[model samples]
Target: MDGDAWRPDLTSPVGFVESDSEGDLEPSDLESDVESVGTSVISGPPADVLEADPAIIVAVGDSAISAVAATDLDVPVVPVGDVPGLSAVDPDHVSNALESAFSGDGRVRAHPVLVVETPGGGRERAVFDVTLVTAEPAQISEYGLSRRDESIAQFRADGVVAATPAGSHGYAEAIDGPLVSAAVEAIVVVPIAPFVTRTCRWVLPNDGVVLSVERDEDPVVLCVDDRTVERIPAGEQVSIAADGALSTVVVPESADGRD
Candidate 1:
């Protein structure tokens, strides 16, 4: 399946009648009638977006490289994460990845980071590369913005995820978002458990898209790289922009079959 594939057909519909708890869940008695669902593997972004410039891409923690791009010195090592976005499968692979990045021409791939401003006058940031804006129970969520007085897409769903190409392989992919190529120059916005049957995921241009969320109910949470979590209180709003860049380490061409 393509990375951007949407499956609203597998989602349950919203009912008009309100219930006490969480309200209006699909009737449990209709479970058997809904039919069992199947799964499909979504591929990553298209090949054309991958720019091969024979550059050395290093995988470093955000703390080490967040303020500036590390292009002056050689990156000796990289810490790997078990999570798909930052995971480096094995020791040999890690070594090869570093070697490939080091031996290649001196250049790096850049992935955008999110700059989040909270209602409390506080701010947070993320690189390497997605920020999940969602609510619990996977249902009570809606996100939208009226830019320059024009209302953009008002996404109503259980959750909304905005991920960059480098981070697309992680939570974004797990939530059925497209696996954007790390080299792609776009951001993927996917709705988790959408109520609308024909809801479409957005592959927005990365010219600094801002997502604003506001409501009168409970606060919606923001998770940055699954590490930092913030809540935007009722009536207040939080804005997320595709800002900054995260440089990554690349796997070498010579280590093709080591896995």
Candidate 2:
């Protein structure tokens, strides 16, 4: 990941709402604050936001930020609520964060997005990770990993996860995966529960990596970020690569200082 100083025009800001009932903050209250700062607020769905093409996007919560990341839009995102991976200001400080961003006091960090291609010609983007796992619980399946036409390893496990640096801190870290720096362009690959006592986890290059379901007694599914996209049968291949990046705003005081 790379970062540059970015100061967005706050004259027109878009508010992307996922859920307003989480904390004490409400959508109406946020709109009033935006107006108080002499900025126009446009609130709608992701598609509407894309169409509106506002100067900056204000994500209200974790899911809103995830939704903005999933859109793959090349816009600067200022997270206002509790968002993971990147630093976010509290609900009470939304107006201050926007003011700082408008005054060139924020840095724009580019977070890599994972592009997952299925065998059926379908493609999806994930800001965090892509997972392949058995459809049923505690079911072991055979999976093969490779990169640039070279074989890496084959193992039996409940599932396998390929996570980006931003995602490496979440589920991947819980499974003892390495914490990759945001400055490094790498993918953290880890097996969920390997049959062998000691299995290997890899931090591979971000491109040209392929995962195939070698053998499966049960059905398997492919997940992009949070939701299951489709079922992947045996003998099919799934390719992942770092296609583009998401621009996220990191305010001065809200910086978590974590890679």
Candidate 3:
């Protein structure tokens, strides 16, 4: 019940006869009706809000590029959930996507990192020189932040969160990073266990925009899944985004020449 959504208790009116009033009144049942009639109000681009707009544009790289925009226009995101005629499909914005994809220098050197408190409250200095090989940080680096996930992990820095649809099921979901429905249309970006992490996870960046985290405090640190690399020491920078990469899927629908 924090940000995006919440559950509420429903109540109904009831009638009763007072002992002084010589009348027999039928008492109304409120419990069962409340339980049966209540409905969850799915947050973000509610079906009704999306009904007003017609275009639901989602770019490649699993970024919710058009999600908020479409929602703002009252257009339903492609597959925020299932719709009778809705189907999961590839994003139409590919030219730019391909440009970003190929632009991958097989390297990213952007954002400047900063130091913060150590998880154990020690003066342990840590850094990260993460290389987005086949492994990850590929997408996160797309933002070209100064020294984002590209750095290795260290004590001061707990870890870098290279979030995606595949990894989002866990903590990402908890942070309200958009849920990946059965259909593939959105991606959730979440940073886990960041020593100086923000109170809440930020939204995934589009292929064009950049996500830069400022080091407001003295020192900061990010360990890679808890492993220390010591590259992103205090006062460094970082970058993130989807590298020019494609994860092919073999859905039966695609074989049928459809989504």
Give me the runs in candidate 3 sitting further than 4 Å from their true place. 1-162, 174-176, 180-187, 191-198, 208-230, 251-259
User: What is the clash count of model 2?
Assistant: 0
Whole-model lDDT per candidate = 0.45, 0.80, 0.27
Q: Write the per-residue lDDT of candidate 2 for residues 1-259, one digit (tens) a residue.
A: 4467778666566555554445555556667666766776676776687677777877766566667777887888776655556676777777678778777888888888889999999989887888999999899999999999999999999989999898888788888888887789999999989889999999999999899999979898998887789999999989999999878788865657365
Which candidate ranks first by TM-score, i.e. highest? 2
Q: What does candidate 1 score in Cα RMSD to the true structure?
A: 18.8
Candidate number with the higher lDDT (1 or 2): 2
Residues 190-237, candidate 3: write the lDDT tens digits: 443444444344334322212233332332334332234333433334
Off by over 4 Å in 1: 1-89, 95-107, 128-135, 145-150, 251-259
How high is the lDDT of residue 210 in model 3? 22
User: The CA-based lDDT of model 3 is what?
Assistant: 0.27
lDDT of 1 by residue, 81-147 (tens): 2335543324324434433433442133345666666667766665544343455555365666433
TM match of model 1 to true structure: 0.57
User: Residue 68 CA error for candidate 1 (Å)?
Assistant: 11
Stronger candidate by TM-score (1 vs 3): 1
Clash pairs for candidate 2: none
